[model samples]
Target: AAGTLIVGGGQAGFQVAASLREAGYADPVVLIGDEPGLPYQRPPLSKAYLAGKTDAEGLNLRPASYLAEHRIAHRPGTRAARIDRDARRLILADGESLPYDHLVLATGARNRDLPVPGADLAGVRQLRGLADADRLREAIGAAERVVVVGAGFIGLEFAAVAAAHGLAVTVIEAAARPMARAVSAETGAFFRAAHEGWGVRFAFSAGVTAIEGTDGRATGVRLAEGDVLPADLILVGIGVVPNAELAAEAGLAVADGVRVDAFLATEDPAISALGDCARFPSAFATGLGRDDTVRIESVQNAIDQGRCLAARLAGRPAPYGAVPWFWSDQGRHKLQIAGLAGPDDASVLRGSGDAFSVFRFRGGILRAVESVNRAADHMVARRLLAAGTPLTPEQAADPGLDLKALAT
Candidate 1:
């Protein structure tokens, strides 16, 4: 009650509690999570975990014994109902209240539901938690024809796994291309070709109107264009809606997400938010007629923000300014993105063949770099962007120029 009370036991929450202890903070750290198990990795749930390549134990951020040894109280399967900011307390759904010297809102985002008829069918599934992954894995085994409603990272990843299993996989996307909002056109086209080579089908600029079902189980997905795609299972990976209702109810600044300053601190000094739920100012933000604050949903952002907030809580205050980076493993190729790119950003190509990097520039300034199977370029891009080193489009286009040397 006298220490930190962390709500939402995701990666960010786990990191904050772990970092607080690592920083030698002798405060009583109690983490409250609605989930029924210890905090585990979420990214793998759509990839290796669903493929049965990794067990649930392998996904654990740490064993229960580690938490006990660290003296961090972890309350699993408990939901936080309200934030009593006036009393500096977090009210739980069970009518229990937790008082805290410092409050952390790490309530991560939830999977966006498919708003269509028959979406609640038994064969329709979403991958978010361990339980969801467990069900998906079992479903994939029995499913012959799989239809993914979105071509986002999670959907693509699941499609790759299904394709590998020799299942008929079709990815339907409302956008013109896969990952339209995230990656550049060149990168998206490359991945499109790659996924196609793996026997995966894609329906671009298509929307699901309804899921056709029989016997309370999904039979296929009907598109807006009056076409029905047959499927034994439907996987919806549209996106996520941030869990900012609690913060909003508590009278905290909330827009697309819980608004926080660069330090990840809300208007109230005692309250802070991070992970996928908090939108804070980013130096890497494109800010080209868009919100300067970004709510990134990657492991990098979660861990970095957690450490940043943890340091501030431990008396070493520094603004959260880590270079944003993200990755997705689809089939044999790996896509790694460094920095943040604007939609209208100009792209420059470097390297060739199946492996290359797309350097995106906004207003003649390097904003982001997307690397495909080129880990070297990704590392250099992050270093260059983080140090604010000026990388000209000409230098990026030049094959002879050594980015590693320049970064060094």
Candidate 2:
């Protein structure tokens, strides 16, 4: 029963534990989490959960009884103080040591705090966990005006919800467009216009100097240009920082995150990392003549990495290479991206308006597809990318062509 010790009871951690059991690994499986409840899906925290469409119980990734049935020793409300590589022990905050033959780090990431004056005000909040969502839901119900600090997915999604609640909403982004770092310029413009159509105001290329407070609560936000926008509540969704200090302290190679090889294994043979915390060289990138590693913060990356690592640990060693995909729900639009797209990649638009898709090509080969409300195109892109099928921009832009047929 001396086997896998998984730190961080998140999607990746829970998947690894379940995958091990599914692979018939009859050993001790311990999953530790700093949160007080069962692992839950995080995407809903900003979307459905914040809108009161779903409750905390609905956010649970799996039923509470599932852990008991799988024989996974899930320690909730616990934190790992440090990892001893030589001793193969995980030291807990309460002074308990857990021995393991293999260790997996799914530590994930934390919400980056807004470091500015009045940031500690009562009405200012950041959404990352269940508790954060609960507090935000209560705040949104009573808020008259909501000011969002970033125009990323979380910010836009929450802004849509706030707007739906009949509250005045304004989103301030330091970047020139919404989701500038993640999506292409065309896709960013589409979402920006879509959000605007839904009664949301945007302040692009705008910097926040400070938050204005009154009676220990946020009253508004001060722009870099000395203009103050009034708001009753403020939400910060700038970005996230990987929780890789635990692995770095144990001498694991860490850059933007814990650097891993193609197999998702760290420098230590017995230790591996996955999910948002692992930065590994992507096979997809290597095919495109880039050897640099990437740290993806999507559920697809986490679940795929977990299953890949599980199979390898269970005597089915294979390099981890899965076509990454992501989706975000904002108001009436459902934006989906299949495969990875670099900043320099050329984009070709197909269709138009809300039902169109943007195909990204690097050196005449399709790299990624960003589809807005086009689920069929997204599904086709996933198959095409996974098969490594060469797609030309001309073929993608042609309305008469069948993308799904070409993929097969």
Candidate 3:
């Protein structure tokens, strides 16, 4: 009999399989992935892997032997054509069917493609999967100048790597500041200043009209005003879109992603969704007077949600509730965020300069914390948020008190 079937062999899918075995669920667990390889971590693709600091073996969450030893059957480079909910089977692209008792959709996401003239040029690259990263690493080696479209985390990380290599890096952002969607204005300004100090150029409030090229190879980027920024390479890092088409075709609820409840379960009992593809009402948000749901895209969320789902399937039923956190490494700076912070959340500054934290408050209650080069503050903030500990803006802004001590 089938035990558990997980679609999409990314971090979430791998974690779910691993967690199931750890929880003593001894049934057939089949992980089907469209990618060709053992499940690997995607985080390093734009950073360490791109920078040549780490190799492909290091990006792997588990070695191939571990998967085989654990009896977690993984179908690498195999795509799931559709979900047969009524028959409780997953239809493969090759016309094979795999029956399952429980299904976990960790379809994840794909990088948003740039729609403009000459976007399909030879040197125009996007960093998403291992293949993309591999191509980009090779491209960067011969590139004299790099132009990045978008100022999001991925864009900045790639820009940092390029800038460090002494390449002329120019980042174009349609928004007023970097990371406008994720961080507050204060935090955005701080990062902008930091990136500028690193010899990276920024063109904020600028829209890309087209990509200029010769012989079908990217050579430069053309702005909305008809001015072209010369470049030998172009990396588009403009966020991502959930791979929710399969779920939607199967008639599952889908908005920005597959909509699930607090338990990460869909309306149908047999199927569930996790990671970047699942949009669920957050307990953390609700506690802070936010009635809506949020779809988080991060390694931490995927791992935590996978473990939560695994436990429930192992006959230890519990609602999925965990404080969300994320981190980004841009050059020497490590920016970490604990809990979810909305755009309109009131932000209070704690500390100053290179090492600092931004306490985000919603309705006078601390909702999230964004820290730059402050690992201790990030850890403490996570604990406090997880335990529902009260922390006022006044207390957070004061440098005299110890944030970590209060967490305990």
Candidate 4:
């Protein structure tokens, strides 16, 4: 009997499987992955991998021997079609059914496609999986000019890589600023300047109306302003839609993602969700007495949720209380964020020179921290937030009181 069945073979699924083994859960564990390779890190795809600093082998999370030695059954290139809740079985594409005592839906997400006239052109691409990255790397190496369709994290990241390689890169964003939804305007401006310093061009408030191509090969992108920008390659880094279709089809409630409680358990107690696909309550905030849905798409979130879920599944039922953190490597600067900040939150700048930290405040209460090229600050923020330490804006503004010192 399949003791536990994981429906995604990315970070979360692999992490939970490992955590279960570490916690002394000997029941059979099976990981099902739609992707055709060993689980790997997605963050490097936009940075190290794109820049040729790392290869596929370097990005793997686990080796084949490790999985085998752990007695974990890994099913690669196998898709879980549906979940039969009544029978406690998972339907596979190959007409096979696997019985599970506990189920984890870590289906992750897929890139949102560019809906335009020439979106189907040969050169148009989206980077969500390994296959997408492989195609992007090959296209970038051969292209003279590339048009990026978005100013989000993925778009800017790919732009940085392209610019570092001395390729002519144009980034088009419908929004006014970069990472407008995720970071403060100050941080966005800082990143914009950093990318600009690397010779990346931006077209803010511009939308791609169509992708112009010839003979099914992309040649240019038409903007909303009736302007056509010529390009040999087009990379669409718009955003990603959660792969919650499976859960929805299985009659599980899916809002932005598979909705889970504070314990990371779905409405069905036997089923749990994590990673980019699970919309669980913010444990850090909720434990501090704030109730809100906090679905995050970061490596840190994936790992923490996976570990927490595993601990609970192993009969230890610990409330999922993890501070959300994220990082992005753009050019020489590393943008790190600790905690979740809302759009209306006020931002205060701390530190100076090339390294700085932006403290986000909501009603005089420290909500989050965004640091660029300041690893120490990011670490401190994580610790303080996880420890439920109170931080005021006045304290954050004081340069003498470093984040690390305050945390101590």
Encode model 1's per-residue lDDT on 1-408: one tens digit a residue: 489999999999999999999998998999999999899999899888888899898999999999999989999999999999889999999999989999999999999999999999999999889999999898988999999999999999999999999899999999999998889999999989999999999999999999999999899999999999999899999999999999999999998789999889999999999999999998788565366888999999999999999999999999999999999999999999999987679999998889999999988999999999999999998999989999889988999998999999
In order, the Cα lDDT scores of the candidates are 0.93, 0.91, 0.91, 0.89
lDDT of 2 by residue, 293-313 (tens): 789999999999999999988
Give TM per candidate. Answer: 0.98, 0.97, 0.97, 0.97
Distance from true location, Cα of 162 in model 2, Å = 0.7
In model 1, residue pairs whose N, Cα or C atoms come closer than 3 Å (at least 3 residues apart or on different chains), thus clashing, are none
| The candidate that achieves the highest lDDT relative to the unseen native structure | 1
RMSD, candidate 3, Å: 1.4
- In candidate 2, stretches whose alpha carbon ends up further than 4 angstroms from where it belongs are 286-291
Candidate 4, lDDT over the whole model: 0.89
Cα misplacement distance, residue 62 of candidate 2 (Å):
1.3
Cand. 1 Cα-lDDT: 0.93
Error of 4 at 73 (Å): 0.3
User: Model 1 TM-score?
Assistant: 0.98
After superposition, the stretches of candidate 4 with alpha carbons farther than 4 Å from their true spots are 283-291
Superposition TM-score, candidate 2 onto the true structure: 0.97
